[model samples]
Target: MPEIAPLLGETLTSPTAFHAPLHAPHEEDQWWRSSVIYQVYPRSFRDSNGDGTGDLPGITGELARLAELSIDAVWLSPFYTSPQRDGGYDVADYCDVDPRFGTLDDFDALVGRADELGIRVIVDLVPNHCSSDHALFQSALAAPAGSPERAMFIFRDGRGEDGSIPPNNWQSHFGGPAWTRTAAADGAPGQWYLHLFDSSQPDFDWDNPAVRAEFERVLRFWLDRGVGGFRVDVAHALIKAEGLPDWGGRADGGSTEGFPGWEAPMFGQDEVHAIYRRWRAILAEYDGERILCAEASIDPLPRLTDWVRADEMHQAFNFAYLHHPWNAHALRDVISSSLTAFDAVAAPTTWVLSNHDVVRHTSRFGLTDGTPRGGDGIGHGDPQPDLHTGLARARAASLAMFALPGGIYLYQGEELGLPDHTSMPDDARQDPTFARTGGERIGRDGCRVPLPWRADQPSSGFGGADSTAAPWLPQPEGWAGFARDVQAADPDSTLSLYRTALQLRRDLRLGAGSLSWSRPFEQSDVVAFLNGEVLVVLNMGEFAAPLPPGTVIAASTPGAVEDGLLVPDACVWILSTAG
Candidate 1:
């Protein structure tokens, strides 16, 4: 550990100069409070030119599908220019679309088509870091030590005699050292720069005025381009502890796996609130209730809501709720606590079951005694996923999440009940975690394989019908069973379940409502709650339970209630008069 020293720039100070209006005086509607947004990972969504990788045009072509799914908005993952080191998280340019995905014109066209279908667009904003190939980083590498260009990044002199070692013991989110040694123009080992993620992505020094102003400008550029909002990546990480002191061993990127680093110097510092306060003011200048959804993985649970206070971001991902296991007690406790905390701040809570960075919930639920862990080591060894059992629990979980108050996010292919391709070959793996862990971990590739569109067509119809190019991440042969075409025709499929639930959620006015548990019951195996007019019940136990008092309106599994009994591992939506 290194001794604490004064921070490089100014001592943390108050942001009283920043004005965040509590009320949007001219707001049209706060749609995000109840919006069901769907997340689309650009590289795996669809291939328009048959280049074997998904692009913006492909997404534009699929807007009708999203309209059919009844999503209020689409949160497109990074389509920005990138080296693809971290699946576009390592951005080389914030303003332009990557040629691999499409041109800037193509992106504008995507927004146009989605708008025609009444779907808002929320583009991802990667503020904490940038790719090494980014012009700013390139200039930093070419500049001399202590130069203004270098000041934009966290460049520090190494501790050792020859300055060959890293400035600190901090580790990267992927693995290994967080600081990577940079070379001078003469080929000598020079200073080290901070990269909390992969070496290809360098962390920005928020202490620098240039960095702060740059991001604010980027936000306005997109807002002016007609985007509804931005999904902030690593929202809690822009601010670091005073001296960058060590907390524990390397962190698993913001996960709260009983680790001491959950509150470490690297993440969730109090100063971060000031940054979002300024951003809220920026959003206030816009017409729509433009939002900032924090992908913050803060712990102690309550602090997650802090990012969503009236003066700050509009929503923060409910990571703890998504990480809970299938146990009824645990799920109920998390839900109650989450709703209570967010209600106190008057901020909407966001629920998400699957994202591009984690194992698909279907495969995760399939694991026996599944404990929700991060994307490392999930697709490695045996005890192969029991797809049958996993799909059942996932369907039930979807209904339960939809019934909760506040907003919800649907990851691509989640509606199709796609399980993680646990058998992806080691050679095909691309997640930074896999390489950083030296094959000890399989990473998140299992969940990112291109989605299956048509069952009989080549490329699973992810591209054109006769295209011979394969998807960037190969789809498994078994994927045919879960293809969108096949599931679209099956009324009993998970796709149908999601569509029905989403429609009912809107029709029943479920989102933004209050949630309360049902009256005391003897069967602890079943957890039941009422949100608006919908009564949601989930039976996690092995045996069937008596159905709650309600009219069965929808169910995850067909015939979930037979002979007035709710089957185990099932969930149902009912219209009940009882609270």
Candidate 2:
């Protein structure tokens, strides 16, 4: 381990350092273009009522902590009414809060508190599907074939004799056939409905005008309640090809190879653009320049940029950059391609590493073999990660991400350098993917563990000091070391690193600046870029490298720079002292 050292002396020691006023602020209308938004998985954030599950009141209480981090907005995952068969993604009531999370009043309080802190709130909008228990879906089940209620969803006659087989070879994202056969009054096989994800989540028939009009009302309902925007869930899969054609590719959803040259009939259809244009116009009618962000995963890289046209979404998640290997050349290629692609559509690219869905980047970077193992759950039998090495690379990667000229999304607990609970017991897994795949694929439960707040408190202070049940997910025994209270006291802790980096990012307006590669290190393992007067260098090689010409400002890892040499798996920020 590198010897820890004080970073900024007295400035870091002061409690108010993170609360310092921003040196430059952009207009409110264009905030999404260069903002740092934090994503909160509500169930795992904090349990205020001591029910093991986090609620809106808990998130409301943490607005001050987010404000101190200089976050421009908070993007909350779904907390709407649901049976939770698919972790709340299967929404039964789009306009109401689930009792497991809190009442509608609690949501209003959270939005109100966030506004006072100058942080906007963005809620997840799962438009592509809803829970089978949803009122409309339930009514459709009872109605006869071809009824108007049944038209709201993708219900069709199966292809086999007695209508037994699925409509097509489409496979659910979880596993198994995408079409589920419904039962008639006498329990005979009836019409089949399409659900690209879990069977509990039936896809809406966007072709229906009623579905389109209903979503318009849903958008306005939240916009009127003061949410700054919506993160469109499965944005690309909302529109299927004409005639609901059969997929000629693999059953597991065709490979991403030959992406721009070939397109998937099930996803990223051209018709999807029209829907976003209409939604964008709806957002324009609201005050405060509301925005829309697509969670689309289109491939061939550049084709993903189509979702962010000027009249469409304000931004789209850059999955290409997130999934790139931890190689210098690979990272550079993705970064260059992302900036170029989004620039063509006049949209600012969004950068993200970890979220509730995938393995935390700390663990992902730690794998020596670099096998893609954690997209599903990482079980006890799986190869373990070297967390020590992972933390070093994760810190370095974060610095590189912040130096880019676009918006940033930070997953909860990443600032404390938390890794996925790779060894989580198999029986404790809750993701539907696990049950659907019958243990063949372990699920996303490892990354969804509750966060640690205080080192000494029960459940790592996630449930507060009050009496209650255990956390929804069991926290690792070593989590006490990564607690917020523990890291806040150590000047060299990852928490301090994030606090200092975010503060500098806001003060320098780095997000609004342009990026240019450092010519000398361009062909080497060093990723060195100049963002205006600031120079950011990330050394991904095994050997030490000489420092670029500048005055050192901040380093990602303590002791990253020694005798003017930067060690491997580290990053540093330097300011041009010579004009």
Clashing pairs in 1: none
- Candidate 2 residue pairs that clash: 377-442, 377-443
Each model's lDDT comes to 0.82, 0.85
Best by lDDT: 2
True-structure RMSD for candidate 1: 10.5
Model 1, position 144: C-alpha lDDT score: 90
lDDT tens per residue, model 1, 1-579? 222112211111112211221111112247888789999999999888887999999999988988887898999999999999999999998998999998989989988998899999999999999999999999999999999999999999998799987787888888888999998778899999999999999999998889989999999989998998999999989988887876564464454455554568888888888999999999999997788899988877887888999999988989888887878888877887887787778777788888988878888888876544556636646567678888899999989999777889999999999988887888888998889989876778888899888889887888878789878998877887788889889999899888888998887767756666654321376777766556677888877766644478889899788766778789988776542
Error of 2 at 78 (Å): 0.4
How well does candidate 2 match the true structure in TM-score terms?
Answer: 0.94
Candidate 2 lDDT over 1-579, as tens digits, reads 443221332232122322222122234438888899999999999889888999899999988988878899999999999998888999999999999999989999999999999999999999999999999999999999999999999999988677787888888889888999999889887899999999999999998989999999999999999999999998988888888877756443446444332356678889889999999999999888788999987777788889998899999999888887788889878888888788877788899999888889999998878778536757788888899999999999998898788899999999999999988878888898988899888889889999999888888889898736898888887998999999999999998988899989989988887776655565667787767667788888877777744577889887899877788899999885321
Q: What TM-score would each prediction reach against the true structure?
A: 0.93, 0.94
TM-score of 1: 0.93
C-alpha lDDT (0 to 100) for residue 101 of candidate 1: 93
